[model samples]
Target chain A: MDYCRSGFKPKRSLEIILFTSEEPTRFGISCLGSRLLAGSEALAEALKATVDGQNISFLEAARSAGYARDEDDLSRVFLKNDSYSAFVELHIEQAPILEEEGISIGVVTNIAAPASIKVDFEGNGGHAGGVLMPDRNDAGLAAAELMLAIEKHATESGSLDTVGTVGILELYPGAINSIPSKAHLEIDVRDIEESFRNAVINKIHKAAKSIAKKRKVTLSEFKIINQDPPAHSNGSVIKAVVDASDELNLTYKYMISRAYHDSLFMARIAPMGMIFIPCYKGYSHKPEEYASPQDLENGVKVLALTLAKLSLR
Target chain B: MDYCRSGFKPKRSLEIILFTSEEPTRFGISCLGSRLLAGSEALAEALKATVDGQNISFLEAARSAGYARDEDDLSRVFLKNDSYSAFVELHIEQAPILEEEGISIGVVTNIAAPASIKVDFEGNGGHAGGVLMPDRNDAGLAAAELMLAIEKHATESGSLDTVGTVGILELYPGAINSIPSKAHLEIDVRDIEESFRNAVINKIHKAAKSIAKKRKVTLSEFKIINQDPPAHSNGSVIKAVVDASDELNLTYKYMISRAYHDSLFMARIAPMGMIFIPCYKGYSHKPEEYASPQDLENGVKVLALTLAKLSLR
Candidate 1:
C-alpha cells in the first residue's frame, strides 16, 4: 500500500488488484473469492478434470443465485493476453512445526482443505427422572459416545498431517431435566492425504452405525457440508518464495499448511505460492496468537521481492 | 364444596380451609404449603425431631422475607384445641402403573424425595487439531465417561425404587474446533429408603473420583441441591382411603408415588393420605396429560367419601 501511495510503478502495466470475496457460497467453500477464480476459463477446465459435480461449481451456483458478472470484475474475463503468471499469499503458520523449529519464514507446500460432515441422531424423549435405563433411548448419550469415538478413531489412525474436529455438538430442547430426543454434531475432517481422511471417516461411519443399532436410536445420514481436496502450491512459485527468503537472509522451510486460506481456491486458476510467519507456540485463531516483529518484517521483505520478481517476469 | 353451598352442614363447625404456601424457601423443599403446616404446632415439632434444621423451617424464612400474615387465615393460627385430626389429597398419578394396569384408583402410601448431586470437572484446553493423545486432557471426554458410568452404577444398584438421573450434562466453551476445558453434570438420585439413596450416591462419588484421576482433571466438590427423606402416608389415613375405595366400588392399589407433591411434607404434621386417578399413559407435566371423565368422577366420589370420614373422626 505504501509503494502504491508513493507511485512506485512496476515495469509492466500492473493493476495492483485488491479482491475481496467475503460472501459464502452454498457449497460451504470459505469465500466468494474462490468463485471469482473458478469463473476463469483455466480453473473451470481444471476443476472439470477433477471433482465431478461433487457439488455444483461455486461460481455457477453464485451466478444462478443472482451474482451477475460486472464488467469491472477481472475474474469474469481472463483476456488471452492478460493472464496472470503467478500468485502469492502470506499468512501466520497455524501449527507448531515452524515455531518449534524456530524458523523465521515458511514457504507453504500445500493447503489442507476440509470435508465437513453433520450427523443428526434421534431418540425417545421423557422425564430424565422417570426413564429407566432399559426403557430410555437417550440421543445425548449416543452423541457423547460418537464424540468420544471420533476422538479415538482420529488418534488411533496415526495418519500424519490428518486432523478431525467436532465444531458443534448440540442437544435440542436443552433443558436439564428432560431427556434429549435429538442431537446434532458438526464434524470437520482435514488431511493432506485424501486416502487417510477417507479411512478415518469410514471408521467413524461404522462406529456410529453400530452404536445407533445398539442404542435403538435413529441416526440420520451424514450430510457433506463442505468437501474440497488439498491444493498444492506451484513448484516454480515456491522456488520464487525460496529465492526471495534467501535474498532477505531468512531461513525457510517447505511445510504443509494445516490451515486453509483463500489461496487454496485461488490456486484453481493461477500458479500460487504461500509464505508463513511463525506464531507463538503454534497457536492461531486465538486472541493470544502472536508473531515476532522481526519475523513479520522478514515476511514483508520477502513478499515484496517475490511480487516484484513475478511481475517483472 | 357443593354440600357447604347447599347448607347441608356437618355437626361440627368446619373451617373449610383453603390455604396456600406458594413461596420457595431456601432448602428447595417443594410445597411451601407444608411450611404452613410446619408452622402448625404438630408438624414443626415432628420435622425438628427428624431433619435437623432443614434450613431453619420455611415459615421462618417466609416471615423474614416479608410474607405478612393475614389474621383471618386459619393456617396462621392452629389454636391448641383446634388441632387437626387428618389430611387427605387427591391427585393424578404421575406414573404408569395404574394407567398400564387399567386400575381406577391409586391409594398412595408414600412420596419419594430426591437427593440431587452436581459435579464439575475441569481439564486443560488446547486445539483439538494439534493436541495428541497421551498429552491432552479433554474434559468433554471425561464428562462422557462419567455420564455413562452413572448409567452403569444406577443400573447395577438393584435397590427397589432407587433412581438416578442426569438432568444436566454440559461441556464448557463447547465449540467444536477447541478442546473443551470443563464439564458439569447435575444428578438426581431418589429412593423411598434413605440408605439406598446414600448407597447409589456413594457409588457415583467413587466413579467420578476414579474418572477424574484417570483423566488427570480437577474435579469440584459434589454439591447436594435437594435432600429430603421419603415421606410416608399415615396408616389410619390410608385405611380411610381404602375403605372409601371399597365403598365406591373402585379397584385400588397401595401405591408409592414416585413424583412428590405438597402432601409429602404435609405428612409430617397430621396423619395424611393421597388418592390418585390415572392420566393418559401416566403422563403428567405435559400438555397432553389427560384423565378419563369416568376415572375423574370415580376419584372425586371416593375423595368426597374419604374427606367425610376424616372430618367425622
Candidate 2:
C-alpha cells in the first residue's frame, strides 16, 4: 500500500494476500490457507480437523469466523495455473546466519521439509526403592535414551541441514517416589534433503526399538505425524531477486530456509520464492525474537524492485 | 478382629491402630499418620502442608475428616516413649523376592529410607527446525543426560540396596515442534544405608552441574525435599517374630524392607518390626497387586503368635 501510494505502478495486475493459520496453532496443520489455495490434500484434512479439546472442526470454526463457503464451492479458493506470474514471501530468517555475516537480505533457494513422530514407551512401574535397578523397567529412562539417540543420529548424519528435537516428554503417574510406568515423546526431524531427513527418522525408529528391548520397555506406539518434501524456489524467481538485489546495491546471500513458509505449498501451483530479513540472533517462535527496522527496510526495497522487474517481464 | 475372634488373647493390653497416608498421595509426605504419632518434625511440616491444586492444608483436611484437635492439643496424637511394649506391622512383600523364593514369611530387618530432590533446567529455546544442532541449548537434552547419569551413579554405587528413580519429568511449553526451553524432574533415591544413599545423591548433583555446563543449559533449581535416615528393626521384636515363625513351622527369611512403612517412624517411640507375606508377583500400588488368601492367613497367624509372645514378656 505504501509503494502504491508513492505513485509506483506495475504494468501487471497484483494481489496482496494475507494467509491464515500458517502457524498450526489452531488445527495442527501449517500453511492452511496457501495449501487450500494451491488445491492440496490439506483441504481434506482441514475439513476433518478438530481443535484440541474442542468439539468443533476447522471448517466449522471457519464458518463461525464468517467463511460462508460450502464444500461444493471450496474450489473457489483454489488458484488457477495462470492466476499469477510468480509468488514470493517476505519473512524473518528465523536463524542467525544472515545477521552473523552482516548481510541485509537472504534469497532462499530451498525450504527444509519436516517430519514428526510420536513415540510411547511402557514399563513395569513399582516403588522407586522397592524396584531394584536390575529388576526395574523404567519408561522414563527409555525415553531419555531415545532423546539422546535422536541427537546423536541427527548430529552424525554428515549433513549440516539435518536436525532433530524431542520437544515433548510425558511420564505417567508422575510422582517422586513411584517409578514411571509409561513415557511419551514427540520428535521433530528436518532437512533440505528429504532423503537425509528420512534416514535420520529411520535411525530413530531403530534406536527406539533397540532401546525398548534392551531396557525391557514396551514400544507401544510409534506414529508419524507428517513427512513433507522440501520445496525448491523457481529459477526465474531466484534470478529476479538476485538481479534486483544487485541493482539496489544491497548485500544478499543465497541460503536454505530451515523453516517452512506459505511459499512452500504455494510452489505447487505457481513459481514461488522467499525473501528473508535477519532476526536478532536468529531467534524465532520466542518472545525475544526481533528484527531491526533497517533490515526490514532493506528487505522491502529488494522485494519491491524484484516485483517490479517480474511485472515488466 | 479376625485374630481376636480366633480364641487367642494377649496378657497385656492391645490396641489395634490403623495409620493413614503412608503413600504420600495427598500431602506429599509419606507415613503422615505415623510420622506425627512418633513426634517427628513432619508434624510441623504437616501444619503447613497443602493438598496439590487445593487450598486446604493437611491440618485443615484432618479437621474436615473429623479429627478434633487444635495445634495446642496436637500432642494427643503423639505416642509416649513407653506407650507400649512393642509395635509390629504385617504387610505383603511389595517385591518379587519372597514370591520367587517360595517363602511365606519375610522378617524385615530394616526399612530403606528415602530422599527426594527436584531439579529444573533452563535453556535457549527456538523453532525446532530453525535452531541448528550446534546452536541449540536444549533443556530437554540436558535433562535426558542427567536422568541417564542418575541411573549410572545409583547402579554403580556398589550396593544392592542403593536405588534411584526419575519418576516425574515436565517440559515447559511442551509442543511437538518447539525446542524445550525448560525441564523439571523429581528424583527419588533410597537405601538402607544412609551414607550410600547420600553418596549417590552427591554424584547426581555433580553430574547435573557438569551436564548443565557442558550443554550450556542452566541449572535453575536443585532442591532436596527430604533426606531421612534408614530405620532399624528392634532386636526383641525381631526375635519374637522369628520364634513365632519357627514354632509355627513356617518358611521364613530375614530380609530388608525396600518399601518404607509406618513402622519406620514408629520406631522412634517404641521397638518396631514388620512381618511380610508373599504377594503374587510382588506387584503393589496397582490394580494387579494381589496377595493369596492362604498367604494372608499365614501372615495373620504369625502376627497373632508374635503379639501374644510380646504381650506375655
Candidate 3:
C-alpha cells in the first residue's frame, strides 16, 4: 500500500511477502513460513508438533489452513536459489537502543540468533512440613539455582549483546502444602556471536548439573530446541539503506537486531537486509507495543527508496 | 472392627470420630472438621471460601454434604467444652526418621504448625532475545531469588525443626521466547516453635522486598493464608501412650509431628495424643506412599491399649 501510494514505477519486478509463525507462538518453531521456503530441515520436526491441549498435529493444522500440497513431497514449498534479487524487511526496533538514542531509522547490520532449551528437574515430593530441611531434595530450588546461574553467565559473558531468559517454569502437583517433586523450565539465550551464545549455554548446562547434584535432585532432561547462527546483512543492501537514509536527511544508526524475523531465514536464499523504526519504549510482543505515524512514514519512505535503488542495480 | 475382633471392651463409653478436610485438598483449609468443632474464627472465612474451577462455596458444599444445619448459626457444629475425655489418633509417620531408625512406634510430643503465604511479582515482559540482561526486570528471576532466600533463612534458623517449601510457581505469558511478566509463588514455612516459624516468615518478607527492589520489579502481593501455633501433647495423654507402648514392649521414640493432624485442632478443645507407625521411605502425599500391615497392626494395638487406659481414667 505504501509503495502504491508512492507512485514510483520500478524498472525491475518487486515482490512483497508476509511470513507467518515468526514468533513461534503457534507451533513452537519460529520462522515457519520462511524456514520452509529456505528448505530448513526443521520441517520434519514441526510436522510432528502438536497443539497443546487440542491434540492436533501441526501437519493437520497446516493442511486445514490449506498450506500443505503433498504430505510426502514438501519440497514444493521451497523457493528456487535464484528466485529474488534482494530481500528487505521493515520492522519495529524491539529494543530501546534506537528509541533511547533518538534515531529515526535503524539499519540492521546483524540479526542475532537464539538457542532455547527445556530443563526438567526431579526430586522427592513429601509433606512440606513433614520433610526436614536436611532430608529434602527440592526440584524447585534446583531450578531456581539454575535460573540465577543462567542470568549470571549471560551477564558475565563480557559482551552486552548476550541475553538469557527463563520464561516458563512449572512444578508438578502444584499445591501450597505439598513439596514440588518436579520442576520444568524453558530457557532462551541469544547473541550475534554463535560461539558466545553457545559458551553461555555450556555454562548453564554445567550449572544445572552441579545444582542438581548439590540438591540431590535429578536433571532428568536438558533438551535443546534450536540453535541458529546469526545472519549478517549484505553489503549491497546495507549501502542502499544507508544511501536512502542519507538522501532523506533522517537520523539513522547501524544496529544489531536482537529480535528474530523472517529475514533471518531469507538470508539463506537471498541477500537480506532489515530497516527498523523506533516504537514506544521499544516494546514489542505486548499489548502496549506501538510505533508513531511519523516514524512509520519515515520507515516507509526509506524502505521505498532502498527498494528502488536495489531494483535499478 | 479391630476392637470388636480383639474381644476387648471398655468400661467407659467410647466414641470414634473421623474428621474431614484434614489435608486441605479442598477449599485450602486443613482440619476443616476439627477446626469447626474447636470453634476456630476461620469458620467465617471458610464460609466464604469457593472451590477452584467449580465456583462452589465451602458453605454450599458443607450443606450438600448434610453437615451444615443452619448457615447463620454455624456454632451448632461446635463441640461443647466438655465433650470428650480424650482424643487419640493413629497414623503413618510421614517422614523417614522412624523408618530409618527402625522404630516401631512414635509418640508425638508436639505437632509442628505451618505458616503459608502467597507472593506475586510484577515485572516488564518483552521478547526474550530483545530484552538485554541489564535492562530486564524479570519477575521469574526475582521469585527464584526469593525462593532460594527462603530456604537459606529457614535452614540457618539454628533449629533442625524449621522447614520451608516453595511448592507452587506460575509465570504469566509463559512461552519459550517471551520474558515472564508476572510470577506467583506459594510458600509453606513450618517449625515446632511458633516463634521460629514466624521469624523465618519475617525474613522471607524482608528478602522479598529487597529482591523486588534490586530487580526493579513490584512485590504486588504478599498474602498470608494461615499462621497457626504449635500444639503440644497433654501430659496425661502422653503418659498413656508411653505406658501402652511399654506394656507391649515395642521400640518407640518421642518425636515431634511435623505434619499437622486433626489431633492438633482437637488439642484446643480436649486432651489430644497421636501415635505414628513408619511409612515406606517417609513418602507422603504420593502414590508410592505405603505402610506395612505389620506396622498398621502394631499401631492399632498401641492405640487400642492407650484408648482403653484413657477410658478407665
Candidate 4:
C-alpha cells in the first residue's frame, strides 16, 4: 500500500505517438503499468500522518495534493515516493510445440543464440581466356568448391540431429563468363551443442585451407560477427510456473525459446520464465503472421494467475 | 581467252551480307585480281569467271541466294568458282582452346551437340521447424547431393578426359528457409570420344536414380533435347592439308577443331580442310578481337597454293 504512493511506483498507461520518417508515418502506442495499484491508499495515509507528526496542521490526505502536474506540459505528472519494480513479457513460440500438442501455455527453458558469419575470399583476377589451369586463381570456383565441401563435411561429420546449414550464399561479380576475383559469402552456423558448433567451424576452415592450396588462390578469413549465448530460465521460476499451471488445471510443457524476446533481458537480473501460446502456422514478422484470440486470452490468464501467486509471496 | 570470255568470263565484283540484326555486320569480298593488294589475282580471277559463267553463274551456283549487291559481307561471300567456293563465316567460339595456346585459327574436327535434360526431383516442402529427420524429402538437398554425384561420376567413369559441365540449376520457389519442393538442373556434356560421352550420360542417370532412392526423393529423368552425333572432317581432305603444308615447308601443326565452323556444310559436298591463321590473342567476334595481318597472309598463302594445285589437276 505504501509503495503505491511512493515515487518509485510504476505508472502504467497506454501512450500513443506518431513518428514520421522517410518511408512512412507510423502510429504506435506503449502500454505501461505499475504493480503497486493495491498499495496507493495506504501509502497516502502514511505520508499524511508524517506531516501531522511534524506539526503541520494544514496537512490533509488529499489525493490531488500528492499529484504534481507540470505547468509547461500537460502530459507530465509525478508522485513523490519510492518502490521496487519488475516486468513481464509475453510472446509466441516459433517452433510447433504448443500448437501441435494443443497446449495453452509453454514453459520455456532457454533461447539459442544464432551465430552468423561472413567469409570473404579474395584472389587474383585475370582474363579467363588468358589464365591457364595450372596457374590460375579462381575465387568463384573456390567458393563453389567450398560450398560443396561444407555440405559434404556436414553430411559426413554426424547424424541428422546436428546439421550444418548454409542458409545464405551470395556471390559478387557474378557474371556467367567472368571468373570471380573475390567471392563473398555469409555462412550461418547454429547448433545447440558446443562440440558440433566448433566442428562446423573447424571443418569449414579445413576445407577452405585445402581448397586454397589446390586452386592456388589466397584466402583471408574473418569472423565478422557473433551474438553471445543466451541464458535459460531459472529452475525455481520454472518450477513455480509448473506448479501454477497444475493448480489452474492447465497443462504445459518445457521447451527451448528458439527465438529472441524482450524478457530475455529480464532473465539476466532476476529469475525469469516465459509462457508461449501457439502462433498460427508459426508465421511471424509477416502480414500473415497471426495468433488465435483464444490462445492469447489463455496465455494472459496463465500469466495473471502466475503473477498473482508470486505477488502474495 | 575462250575460257575467260564465254564459259568462264570474269564477272563484276560482288559483295556478301552476313546479318541484319543489332549485332555487328560481317562483310566479305573476293577480288578477281590484285593491284599490289592483299588478295591473290589468280584466286580472284577464278571466282569472277565462274560467277559470270552462263551455266555456273553466281545465282545458279549459290547454295542459297539472297539479293546481290556490290558490298562485302563477311558472313556470306568468299571466293567462288564452278569447281569450288570459299565461305567466310563470322562467329564466336565458346571454348578457350585457341586462347589458351595463343593460336589464331581453330581447325575443328567436330562440333559438340547441345543437349537439354529434364530432371524433376519431387520432394515434400513443409515447415522446416516442424519436420524432423526420416520424414523429410528435401529436393534441393537431394539435388545438391546429386550434383556432387554427377561430378563424381564424371570423374570416376575411368576417363578424366571427359568434360561434363552443369549449365543451370533452378529450385522451384527458391527460399532459404523453405525445404525445396522440386529441383531442376540443365547439364551440358562434352567430349571428343563418343564412348566416354555415353559413359558420362549413363553414370549421371545412375547417380540420380541411386541418390533419389537413398534420399527418399522421387526423381523423374527424361531427355527433353538431344542433338545428332558430332561429325568429323573428311580423312582425304585432312591428308591433302598435311601434304600441302609439307610442300609449303611452313612450320605447321595438325590440330583438331575445338569449335564449330561453317565448313561443316562444305564437308558434305567435297573433301574439306581448313588452314588457320593465328588470331592475335585468339580474339574473335568482337571489335577488340583481332588477328594479325601476317597470320591472315599465312592462311591465305596456304589456301591459294592448295587451290592452285587442285585447279591444275
Docking class of 3: medium
Q: Report the Cα lDDT for candidate 1.
A: 0.70
Model 2 per-residue lDDT tens digits across residues A11-116: 8877688999888776777777887898865565546645654766676787778884566345567888778889988999988999899998899999998888
lDDT string for model 1 (A1-313, tens) is 6667776666654444454433222333344355445464444444333322465654454456666444223444443322668778888786667788988899989877657788988876555544555776778778878878887887777775677766466775464455677788877677777777788888888888888999889997677666677889999889889999898788999988766777776777778789999878666445567889988888888888788777777
Give the per-residue lDDT digits (tens) of candidate 4, residues B122-141. 76553332233345566766
Per-residue lDDT tens digits of candidate 2, residues B1-313? 7657886666788779988888888667778889889986556554664555477766678777888455635657777889978999999988999999999899999999888999999998888888899999999999999999999999999898899999999997787778899999999999999999999999999999999999999999999888888899999999999999999999999999988889888888899999999987767776678998999999999998899899888
Best by lDDT: 3
Q: Which whole-number lDDT from 0 to 100 does residue B100 have in model 1?
A: 86
lDDT of 3 at B254: 97
List candidate 1 segments past 4 Å from native. A1-84, A158-160, A284-287, A292-295, A298-302, B1-89, B124-135, B220-222, B268-270, B282-288
Ranking by DockQ: 3, 2, 1, 4
lDDT at A294, model 1: 85
What lDDT tens digits, residue by residue, belong to model 3 across residues B1-313? 6666888778778889988879877677778889888987667555664564578777778778786647655667788778988999999999998899999999999999878999999988888888799999999999999999999999999899999999999998898777888999999999999999999999999999999999999999999888988899999999999999999999999999998889988999998999999999999888989999999989999998999999888
Q: Give the runs in model 3 whose Cα sits over 4 Å from its true position.
A: A1-7, A45-52, B5-7, B49-51
Candidate 4 retains true contacts at a fraction of: 0.03
TM-score of chain A of each: 0.81, 0.93, 0.95, 0.60
What CA RMSD would you report for each candidate? 7.9, 2.8, 2.0, 17.0
Against the native complex, each candidate's DockQ, computed on alpha carbons, is: 0.25, 0.69, 0.79, 0.06
For model 1, residues B193-304, the per-residue Cα lDDT tens digits are: 7787788888888888998899899887678766777889989889889999998888999988766666766666667789999877655444556888998899998888
